[model samples]
Target: MKALIVYASVHHQNTEKVAKVMAEELGADLVPIGQAQPSTLTAYDLIGFGSGVYGKKFHKTLIQFVEALPAVTGKRAFIFSTSGGGEIQTHAAPKKLLMNRGFSIVGDFSCKGWTTWGPLKLFGGTNKGRPNEEDLEEARVFARGLKEKYI
Candidate 1:
C-alpha cells in the first residue's frame, strides 16, 4: 500500500533518521510536516506521522496539520517518535487526534534519541549516539512488518 511519512525532526535529527529508514523500507513518500498539505493525504493508503517528542507530545506543527485535515474517515495510519525517554505515551496526543479523525491506528514505534535540549543539555545528553544502526534496522524491520500487516 502507498504510504507517506511526514515528520519534523529538530534538535539532533533523530526522528528524521527513523523516518528515512521507514520511507526506504516502505517505499513511501517522505516529507517534512511543514511541506505537507492536508488536502494531499488521500493519495496514500497509509500515513505515518513522526516527530521528536517535545514535552510529551509530537511536534506541534504535526498535531496542527492533522487537526486541519479534512475528515479522513477510516484511513490507515501509524505513529512514531524519538525522545530521550522513548516512552510509548509520547505518542498519545497525536494518536488520539488521528483516531478522532477516524484513522485506524495500525501500529506505533518509539526509540530513544540523543537529547540535550533544556536541562538535559547540562548532562551532555540522553541516548547519545542513538537511532544508531541497530535502531534504524529495528525501524526498517518495523516498517516491513507494517507492510505485511496492512498492505
Candidate 2:
C-alpha cells in the first residue's frame, strides 16, 4: 500500500525519526510538510500525519496541512506524535481534527521526548535519548499493524 508520511519537527527531530521508521516499515514515501503543498489524498491508499507536540497541540504547520487536505472519505489514515508529557490532548487534538475531516483513523502512536524548553529540562532531563531505540521499534511494529489491518 502506498502511504505518505507528512511531518513537522523542531528541536530534537524526534518525531521525524519515528516517521522515518514508520515509512521504512510500510515502504512509504516521506514528505516534510514544509516542502509539500496541500494536495489531494486520492493518490495514496494510506496516510500518516505526524508532528512534535507543542503546548498540548501539534505543530502549527501540521494543523494547517490537515485542515487543507482534500476529503479522505474512505482512505485509511493514522496520526502519531512525540511529546515530553503524557497528556492525551497533545495527540488527541490532531486526531480529532483529522477525523472531523472525514479521514478514517486507523491507529495512533506517541512517546515522550526530551523537552527543549521550560522546567521539564531543568531537573536533569525527561525522556532524554528518546524517541530512542525502543520508541522506534514500537513505531515499526505499529506501522506493520497499520499496513496489515488497513492497507
Candidate 3:
C-alpha cells in the first residue's frame, strides 16, 4: 500500500527524526507540511500527520493543513507528535479534526522530545537527548504494525 507522512518539526528536529524512522519502516513518502498539498493526499492508501507539540498542540501549520483538506470517506490516517510532556491528549485535537473529515482513525504515537521552548530554555531544556534510540525504535515498530495491518 502506498503511504505518505506529512510532518512539521521546527524545533531541534525531534519530530523529524521520528518521522524519518517511521517513513523508512513504512516505505512512505516523507514531506514537510509546507511541501504537502491537500489535493495530493488522495493518492495514498494511508497518511500520517505529525509535528512537534507547541503549547500542547500539534504545530499550527499541520493543523491548518488538515483543516483545509476536503472531507473524504474511507481515507485512513494516523497521528504522531513529540512533546516534552509526551501526553496522549496532545493527539485528541488532530484526531478529532481527521475524524470530522471522515478519515478512519488508525493508530497514534507519541514520544518525549528535547524541548527548550519558553521557560524550559532557561533550565537548559527538558527531556534532553529524547526521541532517542528507544523512542525511535518504538516508532519503527508502530509503522511496521500499520503497514502489516493495512497493507
All models, RMSD in angstroms:
1.2, 1.7, 0.9
> What lDDT does the true structure give each of the candidates?
0.89, 0.82, 0.93
TM-score of each: 0.95, 0.90, 0.96
Residues 60-148, candidate 1, lDDT per residue (tens digit)?
A: 89889989987776589999998988888978788888998889989999999998878868888778899899999989999999988
* Selected candidate, larger TM-score, 1 vs 3: 3
Worst 10 residues of 2 by lDDT: 85-94
Q: What's the true lDDT of residue 72 in model 3?
A: 92
**Which is better, 1 or 3, measured by lDDT?**
3
Top candidate on lDDT is: 3
Which regions of candidate 2 fall more than 4 Å away from where they truly are?
120-124
Judge candidate 1 against the unseen true structure and give its global Cα lDDT, from 0 to 1: 0.89
Native-to-model Cα distance after best TM-score fit, residue 14 in candidate 3, in Å: 0.5
